[model samples]
Target: MAECVACKQSSMAQYTIHNVRFFDFNPKAIHCMSYDDATSRLALSRTNGDIEIWNCWSRPFMQLFLPGDNDSSVEAMVWCQGRLFSAGLHGFLLEHNLASREVTLRTPITGGPTWCLALSKDKKKLAAGTERGYVCIFDVVDSGVMYDRALEKQEGRILHIAWHISGDYIVTGSVNCVRVWSLKEGRVARCGLGAADRKDEVIVWCVGILDDMTLVSGDSSGRVCFWNAELGTVTHSVHTHKADILALTVCPDQKSVYVAGVDPTIVQVSRVETGTKKGKVEMWVKGIQRSIHTHDVRALVVTATDRVYSGGVDTILTLSYFPPRTVCKFPALPPLGSISVAREAESLLLQYSDHVELWRLGASSKKGGKSGTFLPVTKDRVKLLELQGKDDEVIQWCAVSPKARWIAYLVQGSLRIYHFTPPASGKQPRVQRVKEVSQEIKKSHQMLWLSEGKLVSAAVTGAIQVINVSGSKAELEKELTLSPGHSVLQMTCDLEGKMLAVVDSKNIITIFDIEKETISVLPGHSSPCTAVGIHPLTKEVVAVYADMSIKEYDPSKQCYTAFCRQHLNEPSSELAKKHSVILRVSFDPDRPDLILLHNESAFVVVQKDKMAADVSQEKAPKVKKVTSGSSPGKGAKAGIGAKFSVIRRPNQVLLFSQMKGEAVVSVELNPLQVMDRLPSPLKVKKYGGT
Candidate 1:
């Protein structure tokens, strides 16, 4: 028995990705990544304006997802102090607090999209490079900007920025040269140009500071150049890659630099001391034969003395270790429409473009012949249930019950509910179709489970339907009708499941009292409403409109008491304009004062009362005042102070957010807190379940 158990344990450890606890939607390219040694967290920015934070040391590997600007791509990200600062194509800088899980807009940069960012060692200075050949510097304190400075322009777009460890100098790489700026003097301290004889001028894409007086830069011509920053002269240059060098990370000892770019290869450059010259060191390339990445490497970080992490277009995070040189890789989930975790069952519910699949983890055993012994084995992924349909039948939305017994999914404007039961022994779980309801509405946009046997669905036709599933067959219990020409765009329910808030095509908000069978419309928006959310504890309804306006409705008064408006300037590109509509509005589950407002170009979080004071008319609503406390009889607000949200993004973006907060029922999940605290495999009994 001991031998069999040991063999099984060995096989599981060898095949499983123990370090990779959480995975996001696959296929979306990773644009940038940063590692904070202090927090032991890895932050990744993807092409779809989604940010993912992973705690490397946490058990079950905690992950957090912060939603980005709708349709906007994140250009750069960096971790400094206790905050994650990110820049995107919208030209705004975002500061995300690791502790509070709150995001705030720092400032907007001029010239154009900020491509690269760097923070000084003292955490007081920040430097950003813009696409229009300008470098901007800011005095940062507690993730807020104190002052700003725009340095002199160079020849081309600034691609990369690196600050000196001493906090006095910054090096920026641009089209044809590398320039070092002195923050104390606010001027160019030194500049090094590329070779003038070459036919094509080299574009500097990445820069790394080796020391206070030394700088290393990589260019499009694949040349790595070492320069003496104090003297403004190149000391050595070597060809490193086949094409542009996109990322570079310097070792903690300052002895070697790891480089990766357009090519799949990762090369290490070390400065070797020469015996003949006492003060001179020659640069040599130590190449790794195995390709660690399948696509262009866009980001690199040195996590420790011997460990490095790299991610890129391939959507894979690779960990490379030195000395003996070992590598481990983690791949994201295959590009899916949506993903949800059934925490109690240790199962993953995934929605693909054409099908829905439930994956479960369980223990299996194999008999060792002639020994009369059974070896305990573990199945990493077992497809317990799969639901597939025709190509045109796409799943629009899905929801799982709290007990993991009922699953509801919407396909082609119809709703389907299934009852799931795990097998008694080693058979596949049975997924029995319990209910199917067809609707004549144009499109069913959203669905939510009010209870295990009850569901509420909203359609674009301004109709809301309540279905009951407790009687073996699904039946339409209540159908609520709205005013003509008003199409429901977004809908949300209160924590108690008694009040439903709906945003309509005409920019109106309708609050429905489920128990009383009454509806009230709150008047205050100028443009069409896009998203709506209800506060769990206070029963406040917040709505966002296409004109970038936010309003909070007081349920007791049936009026808008507070409002906030976001003033977005004219868009720079056609793509930006196409996605300019307001996408979502939500309140922080823990803090009712904090509200998240998202548009196509940016995600802005503001304090509700403060925002009201800033942009709203406090006396606009003439209604009776009511106490802002939790009510007594209404099922004690189901998810009070629970960290979650319902704002939906693209498939990949939503999946990333769901994976981070797998244990919570929120629109957005906080990475700092999650409920997936499964015991370590080593602590489980030999034949026990995961």
Candidate 2:
């Protein structure tokens, strides 16, 4: 626990918290990562071939997640011209369509089982280093990949590949040497690595290139070796690690380099200038280093966001800054918005790469328990149904109807609807798939269920389509136009599902009327809105932005509504400024004036009753930061007041739901649980140590 803070909720002391720590979030190790500076987006692949595109601006948000199946795997990935390209042991070159959220192309690799991928400086040529020691180059044109040529075959597998700034040469690391391949002359030079006595001691695992034709290689010998590839000579070699090096990333400035490996520590090597100004001696010097990961790091990337990110078998994504304020860890929980709650049925729908699980929440006899103790179960939680997609399909969106009778999900532009009935006593729940869903509603961005068996979908055509889902059929009812050429990213509705609030990609927030077929575009913000929620009591929309700013808009009046004029001052608070992108904003039905906002870590509770009023001019409200719980709890809506308390979750929160019970559900990913399933970690047994 962190600390205790003052809260505005007088009833929070009695609130029942269903801290669910049993949900199995089987996270896979990160295998590769690629970053796009233009979009500030990072694309990473897991051991299961699942790929997630994270918006790595103010926060690393999992904007898009593409799940993988049993036969899929990814070893390397590259982002080229706003598109994502990945390769793996499957021997296929995959180019994914971000708009369609699917694999648009899968070209087989002739080199067999690609181990790495690199893009040319011009972003026109794509290269894949494969198991058969062949470098295959392809042409990337207009969102497509076309095979071009394969370089002369070498002796060993190409484990890593990197391109020169001029795009004239490609550098590859293999079994015991690093080779530089000239586009015209094939393999121009090679620098052998490792000691003569050890065969596989110097396995080159990762490689990079400098502008001056200098080749950098990280190998199994725990060394960061610099090679003059043009002349096949070793320029310098530094043993920066005590174990094998696995990942290396060059800073944008090219003056600094970050390398990490089995030692689990990130080492910063900088180009330092020594001696006098007239005769300066430049060398790469070992600078300050930080140890964040507890296991080997396989993927490392440094972005202009001033944050260096690394991930590996530990399944934790760590972000560290240079001077170090605090190291933030994005736990390997299913993407934040992936858990959908069915309040009426007291159930939850958890989204995975290839499947969706519907679990009926359990109840305890008591309301609250000790901080570290588990409550006695009155009713056992049940996994009602696990709906899995086909081999060729990847689940994109999933939702459970408010009543939990209808479960709908989208897989690669194909929609599937299921009718579910919660079991009675010991009876099994009935699950039936609707075969006659409307064909026209297949290509939608997001889908949610409203009241009266009405399903609303945000179509790719920038229209909200209403569908009537009956016992075994679903039909399109009406299509209301939203913002043209813009896609809706998130959608929320009131308890009755009457008032719909949606935030689009263009940073616009719009309220759509279902029965009236009308649209009210709220005065939107300039920054990207991360979440939007409607207060069930007041029907007011609360929008949270990337900069940690909050706004409340009234749809009926088409105007901004706020008690305190200093509401914008919330982001200026030290607590709010440190938070990540606000993923969700929830309103308590009983306390509509209280808005509950949370990102990846902390929960901000705002109460309007104690709002700071501007008698002459509004002053900034007082801020409270707490790690430990005192009398306060997690049930707060949005408000601007002196009781603006930020409650930081002690562990990485997985899912928090407000259901029918007087309880708050807290699910967290326990690292020990994951470690139990993994093999024994590599360890040096200190005398008598466990």
Candidate 3:
């Protein structure tokens, strides 16, 4: 619920359709605001007087903070003529160079309450609306403040103002009528907004002139009215608020109108429509909290994508997501990380930095609710999966056992296993740690199952330990050490679990005959090895190293067979500096010849059959002796700081055919935004459920 300035909580009934998730989108107040010249960027002021520019697509592009002055609050902002203009309570009115990140303060519009600003389309003139009912116009390019005798009298404690597209006329909205003044004329051409015959209070708060012949204005009475420039008469009027209307703007296409008011509601009306009743014109009202102004909507600006930006009392701004004929709404937050469909539980699970959650599918989230609709689960049906004994470990990888009754996780020193039992009644499942395999292996890289009950765990110290968790006493069955001198980064076993492949820091992958207890070393890698994969059915192995090299090794032939170097979309010769490190690789279970490799910025799916023949036909060196860098007993102590605990299934590679897998769902995480709180100043408005 949105808390009132008086500290009262909004009644549940009053906010039954409210979405708190959307309200917290931005936790900061919005000062000056503007849409870019192309309307594809949004710029706003931080309390520190710095300006942050975000692409129209909801991505932040750049930030410009004032260097010397730290506490200036930007009260006004606008983008025009390829530059960003900002003014604030400080004595500074600055023009910023966007491309070079430079700042130049024009003649200081020094005053205590400068709060509003606008720029002409041609970029020749700048206007600052101030707290004293006056506005200052400057020649922007020349850095001239234009304070000649001709410009002094027009100054008043102006609340809001707008520049004509031609840059010849200026419209200033005060506590009364809309004043349209021509620069050359130096006088108001019309002031008919508050004629004696008009019934509404004439405290004009904001003005948005649509064209030379028409304009719109909002006043203290919470009423909005359209005016005809040619006739100098009010054309139509609409009661848009329960309180005073503070800000007004024309829709993107100028076919309709939008007004923000003290009621915390933004009213949209067709230019030709008139009425204050509900559903008369499209309308959206959401609770807003700001201390400086009570629900008093302050700023409004519309940007690309029919997005509307509104700011108010809470000092917060909101961005509304409105589609076509539907009222404006906001994006509902799913659980945290990418969600995937869970197989055993038949639910959607959310994964984050340290948590895994299960959520029951909601009725509306199914195809049954709407054709082609994909909803993960109901927000209220979420459950947290807490792993015992894995409290401070910060799990990095996890795999479920084949049976799905147990989960295997590698922590620090040893392998810890947890057993899960499905709920007998309509309750959550109970999970408990029932098995542990202690290994002196520090920083385990990968863990895979050999047979139904046997598992292989690879450590960073180039050692592999085979553990049997079937009996009461969990114990290691086999221990194989790679060079014993180099560090192991990754390891994987063939589908039959007979051959194990381990890659060391020197990019050398040593193949071990698990049954024979022997090793075959393959070298020639210039970078640290990152990923290795073995065919499930075939004894063939595919290794991808740090130099971005991919090779196929055959154990049966006892040699390297083929190399697929520099496949399609390879980087340019000059740009291909240090090779990219391969992070992960996997072979398709159904298509043995199809391999997938994931690197830092690229994902490649290749067919092994089409790969070129091995370039490495050279005979490899044979090691007649196995010598540990510091001897076996001393190397064994390398696992001193290693620790392990079973972790819940990870969502990264959701469903690996050969491994027990979980489902995945999608969630969004863009650090909280302040503009997401304000009502979009222009076209469409989005709505969230009550």
lDDT of 2 by residue, 218-320 (tens): 9887888888776787877888888889999877778877899888889988888888868988778788788888788999998885578899888877888
Q: Which pairs of residues collide in model 1? A: 64-671, 644-666, 644-667, 645-666, 645-667, 645-668, 646-667
lDDT of 2 at 80: 82
* Candidate 3: residue 396 lDDT (0-100): 35
TM-score of 3: 0.42
Q: Tell me the RMSD of model 2 versus the true structure.
A: 4.3
Off by over 4 Å in 1: 1-26, 58-62, 97-102, 277-290, 334-337, 340-398, 402-690
The worst-scoring run of ten residues by lDDT in candidate 1 lies at 8-17
What's model 2's lDDT at 166?
A: 95
Model 3 scores a C-alpha lDDT of 0.51
Query: Between the candidate structures 1 and 3, which one is better when assessed by lDDT?
Result: 1
Q: What does the lDDT read for residue 44 in candidate 2?
A: 84
Tell me the whole-model lDDT of each prediction, alpha carbons only.
Answer: 0.61, 0.74, 0.51
Candidate 2 lDDT score relative to the true structure: 0.74
Alpha carbon lDDT at 213, candidate 2: 79
Better of 1 and 2 by TM-score: 2
Q: Model 1 over residues 238-280: C-alpha lDDT tens digits? A: 7877788899888888888888888757888888766555666
- RMSD to the true structure for each prediction, in A, is 19.5, 4.3, 21.1
